[model samples]
Target chain A: MKYRRSGRLVDMTNYFLSHPHQQIPLTYFSEAYKSAKSSISEDLAIIKEVFEVRNVGTLETAAGASGGVTFIPRVDIYATGNLIDQLCERLEDPERLLPGGYIYMMDVIGDPLLTQDLGRIFASRFRSAKVDAVMTMATKGIPLAYAVAAHLNVPVSIVRHEHRITEGSIVSINYVSGSKKRIQTMSLARRSLKPNSNVLIIDDFMKAGGTIRGMMDLVQEFQSNVAGVGVLTESIHEEEKLVNEYVSLTKLTEMNVKSREIKVERGNLFDDVYQI
Target chain B: MKYRRSGRLVDMTNYFLSHPHQQIPLTYFSEAYKSAKSSISEDLAIIKEVFEVRNVGTLETAAGASGGVTFIPRVDIYATGNLIDQLCERLEDPERLLPGGYIYMMDVIGDPLLTQDLGRIFASRFRSAKVDAVMTMATKGIPLAYAVAAHLNVPVSIVRHEHRITEGSIVSINYVSGSKKRIQTMSLARRSLKPNSNVLIIDDFMKAGGTIRGMMDLVQEFQSNVAGVGVLTESIHEEEKLVNEYVSLTKLTEMNVKSREIKVERGNLFDDVYQI
Candidate 1:
């Protein structure tokens, strides 16, 4: 391997950070640098030191027939914002129209790469927010919660629609979903959450903030404080109470599935990033 | 920022490969290295080159105040198996005991970091194996599927119960669950899966391999091939067909919740890693 006269650790860390938590074969790296294994191992030691000293990133090495190093979430503000902006642009695309003024952003949510990135970005943001535990309802919310919890190294409590045979006992909360007149119940286990938890709420979609508000009530029942709120897509409507501050990948205003017309708005997270 | 000696691009790529998909704040890296922003920028450029050339990893940077950097899953084989070894150890813990022979690995299965690692590790193992999509049953399997799908960069399709609520229309398959005398049906959308799709089967638990076999039959109905099968936990049975190669985090031979005693046979993935 040609050792460049100038070998920069910061550049290396930045590259590692940007490519956070990606797994590649050792042979791949070996082939790329054409460097002896010993030299590469030494460089990783330095990189690991850099990450540990800062306490903002991690470098893990796994050796064997199926082993290689992998990075974990420890990104700073600059990188987090840049990713949110890219997401907003995708959300802003006019082609995202669906029925009932709802934008069909399933493509974005369904894309594991995008979801993984957004999950890591938000996880970093929430990490500094001092949340006790991250919470999300079933299905879609699981991935987002998983992402955040992974970054923060916290447990994710998933709320199910009707208690499953899995969760022995549950604490249920009944409330109106959005503006709907019907009452719906959402539940968590007493064993799962502690009293007075500092919780960060995350979900795939938020409209009329009812489900989110219900979650807030669920938080209150446990005497927990809503530390913050974050959503993949925030539906546009005035007067969403109980949200102190929020971050969203996309905003849906008016959707006419019949007419095939949908109005979408982007969030400030992206704009804030590009300005930097 | 300090202007110090920089590391080689291959060094950074190797470091990142072992530590795939992490997001760390820019300030953290900047302060750790005491390096100029420009130098760090140059380092990222070189790192990006190795990633592009390799086609096995991705680097995404978020700009602005709220921005940071993250690495997405792009790990190769050597790294993946090592992770599985760690996972199997965690799964083998005595604390994971549950009713019957079931191991309550749902916590790890539900966990983001563990799940992500599991996905990367498994993806690496099956990287060269042809597979169109990752498949799993509803409920618990969703998370596992997402994990594998994230690493493989493939779509995860869900198989539902006999009833059709989550899945409006489905292609059906009938099979026995473990020792159950009665046969049960598993369903997947006829349109959801592409014809002749190569499928990687994953599940939370496999008692008899019947459910997985049912999934195999479902794939056959769609004229698809079983690329491989993966289970979070596989219970030992006297008579379970074992024709195909499979992967499991833990092997459960016996358990008695009342006695609070359990037996766990660890997978061989661990020893292989340590020996190397």
Candidate 2:
């Protein structure tokens, strides 16, 4: 019985190392180990020590009858920002990505762990920022917005492409998504934003900054405040129309789709996080 | 200093209740209170009792210099699963969505506490699976995948849409993403996956199950084994071509796009988690 429990503990620790910032119940682990709750507790104590020795994360236990354990990823800024630079380099391949004038990055956006790590890194940076909520436009922006919001322990308010059934009453605005010739609708629920909220805006990619500007307008309608802005990737050549103390993890510039050429540079946000 | 530290302890315990399952360094809370480290230690003992009486979560202190206090989110499975159902309901709105037949749920995925709670709950369900790693396609799947992976403490394998510089030399495969009309290419790093790995496949949505199938194919290429599959939203009308043991938090179906109508039914995965 002890041998079985110890084996389960090894498996449990391996699982905890992969996920760095979420909690799990003791009963669940006990069941997984096919051992008694007391046995699982002993195993976790040892596993927690392993985490402490590594300096990578912590095995946080919620006590009493109901509580469980959680792991928080503890990558310092230097290690994490490098990962983002790598992501930017991959997306910069123009020959591989461009179908028309638009960049094809659906695949990168679809990647789960990469996005999660990116969000955790952002959360560490914004950990000191007193923001009320995270805001973003529809589709691709939703993922990155969610990542930042998760790290900050804030709610996320997503503006929509078109009005849907979930929004009871709506406030709508039109913004130039690609060019001045094309106007796209951006809508948010009337109740989505609290009055005088300190809002953090996030986006998956930025080209013209029109969608972000429109999102900024939507924030103004609620009489809310802008705390900060973050972009996963931004085009380097295009001049940013409005500068609001924004940060981008990666810079994307000079892409050749046919030649499969791409160049990426790191950002200042990561250094700031590491120093803190 | 002693009096001030004791007062700080009272406040910190109260703060810890609302912000359960969170870790803060000793220096952080101590600096906030402007008290000495030893004084803070005494205060933590008093606070720990309060947590004991309240039965919320545990106040654990790692003794080493790097160790601080962490709170575990320890509610039973019923409350945990119920919250997920509530989120699914929030996502069920047909009107608040877009023309592409997608619900904008980036908001929920980004909330750190909620994501952590959901991750813990889901991880509890698969605690027995001995999963070597968590795998996802990209972007939307990243958040939830990270959550579960965080609790399990496992490395997350990202399957990309195309091979890029960061992934190094890669193995490429072609699969029909949708409707079996267009063959899309997806790539995985040759060295990323350890052979015979027990992988858990996770995604944000499962429509036709093609993406899941493609991911399965990628897992097989590495000679890895799939332990299970999990998705946040499973389209009800979509036929399952491959999966029988998969779990979903919600079922979305009966869509009337014209009337902005839809339905969301909670999945049985929560029941399994709570049963223990």
Candidate 3:
């Protein structure tokens, strides 16, 4: 079926938005729409211009026989700042402060739109990194991990605290808890990741970075490399962090259980180190 | 800034794809594009036509005051059949069989694209239902639930087996496991859901509907109602199912531990009961 220029632009925009980071051959679109290659290229240029002007993302096109277009999702600094400000406001609610200074963040993390926005922010920050798969702990970080993986067009490798029978062969490691200093165990399925793959570690919260450090160790066990580390929120602590380098979206500077006060600020994402 | 028709088509299409089920007033687009309402309407007409023709989704328009356009994503029957067939074929692999007859589905569920597709299937199936939130068990069901929630533009409420400190005043319930006949506890944070909410339950696998039932009970404990239940796969067993009305995308007819054989077929999705 032949699609008009308007229809082609609409369809191709949807395609690029859905299939980010995927290289699509021009022939695929030409045949799908039964349009000329030049027409398709023209449609892509219009879409790319709109995407950039709207701060949606950018389109990278290759120009040879094997050349195609790849849509890389990104959020501009202004938009990201607004999202982080909203997030910090939500995190500052005194009701979210628990008895032990832990914030009840399930509701925030459970929000699909919010998580997707956070995912785009992280994906943009790690756009230059080589991420083969996203890694996170079982319960809390699962949603954020999947969100990032979706934008990156990669699979998620979940690290569970306990070894389940359904995982088959597994690799387990013991690491001390950052907050309590208690020994903890983390494991991953042997088949979940491949050797020599670059992994991006994402988590909901980071304090002393014990969990992130454990994931780093597990990646090493599989002969893989840690491409980058990202956290939704990190608590400011007097104790030294186990992991030296990572990106955090929000920072919890103070949490007073007795006074029911919680303070949150923007993370290191806009820091000089990131330079985004 | 003013946008041409071509640029409006691309921008509007991207917006609709990202913000599914969201009602956007025509004025919003008209003001953003600096185009007249008639021109915006024409652009939407082209988008709607292309969307339906390509099976991308449908654009629902409401006229008069408080009227707007809502994008409801739907996968055609042909596309859904192909996706299900690919899922069944992947599940039938002998390598996915574990020692205790459990299928190693981590890779399949961990995949962002596959889970997103499955989420779309469930979202389309439950599109007519009033779903306030997508509910799922912790660990495995998180991704599927988030996928569905993303399509429906709703939040996800996760129930966990173990209560963590961060949950804060959770509602717990104990139910007998359908497969092992063992009693287990499930809990949800009190603030995770609101009263009188219509919850849609989602899970990766269902053996005898025990865990899903537990989630339903928890929802009830919070003064909420179960809007619907959906499982990625259901195991056919000699024992009767504990719950009757639910949707399953795939059915596991047989699994032989000794022979290392597995047989998977389409679930009740296309049955007379579903009529989809």
lDDT of 1 by residue, B115-159 (tens): 766665566556556668888887677777777777666667777
- Candidate ranking under DockQ, highest first, comes to 3, 1, 2
**In model 3, what is the error at residue B30, expressed in angstroms?**
1.0
- Clashing pairs counted in every model: 62, 39, 0
| Top-DockQ candidate index | 3
Q: On residues A168-230, what C-alpha lDDT tens digit does candidate 3 reach at each position?
A: 999999999898899999999999999999999999999999999999999999999999999
Q: After superposition, how far is residue A65 of candidate 2 from its true place, in Å?
A: 28
Q: Estimate the Cα RMSD of every predicted model relative to the unseen true structure.
A: 10.2, 12.5, 1.2
Consecutive 10-residue window with the lowest summed lDDT within model 3 chain A: A267-276
Candidate 2, overall lDDT?
0.66
Real contacts retained, model 2: 0.15
Task: Report the poorest 10 consecutive residues by lDDT, candidate 2 chain B.
Answer: B1-10
Positional deviation of residue B226's Cα in model 2 after best superposition, in angstroms: 8.1
Clashing pairs in 3: none
